[model samples]
Target: MEKIRLRDIADALGLSVATVSNVLNGKDSKVSPATRIRVLEAVEGSGYLPERAEVLLGRNPSRMVGLVVNDHPEYSGHPLEDPYNARFISFLQRAAVRHGLELLVKTARTWEEAAQFASIWNMAG
Candidate 1:
């Protein structure tokens, strides 16, 4: 199914995107209560879910955590296919969720590859 975006909801309600954004972001003080209700109703009906990365990036440093698995191609191409890596990743995922973090997993054949992803994402420790 195609994803519904915030702009779609705003257009259907005949409201500006900014107004809809304000309502979704809990900054609805300037928006009329009736309009706020309408916007929310439309949003729920449309099933629009905002991107988590965008919301996290709004905060200082971001809430993104990267888990890089150093995989040896000699053993297997897929890092998560290994039982040990899978177990460790499962633990890390639970811990990250408990701390309100978004976990991004990457399997790198080389340290350089891992560093590249970490640098590009600016993943927090």
Candidate 2:
């Protein structure tokens, strides 16, 4: 099914696109309760993903930070078990959280594998 756009909902309800946007964005202080209810109903009926709504409005990338770590057969535990690696991971995690992003730690055997991780979500870090 095609992802529903705000324009479709607004047109169906005879409302301006901005009004529908405001209701979805929780900026509906000035919108009437009846209008809010109508817009919300349309949204639910459309199978719209709330996360995608922000992306459509702002064209934002997937807010993820990917950490590529090397995995060797001889390693006992996670590569992050090393003290230096652990500290670095902790710092990176803190930064990602501070910026409203998530840290995805993955072990890769080669550069090609690491590249796949980055491309999957448009990883920024």
Measured by TM-score, the strongest candidate is: 1
> What C-alpha lDDT, on a 0 to 100 scale, does residue 77 get in candidate 2?
49
TM-score of 1: 0.51
Error of 2 at 24 (Å): 38
* Clashes found in each candidate (C-alpha, N, C closer than 3 A): 0, 0
Candidate 2 differs from the real structure by a C-alpha RMSD in angstroms, to one decimal, of 14.1
TM-scores of all candidate predictions against the true structure: 0.51, 0.47
How does candidate 2 score on lDDT? 0.76
User: Per-residue lDDT of 82-110 in model 2, one digit per residue for the tens?
Assistant: 78778998999999989999899998777
Q: In order, what is each prediction's RMSD in angstroms? A: 15.2, 14.1
Report lDDT (CA) for all predictions.
0.78, 0.76
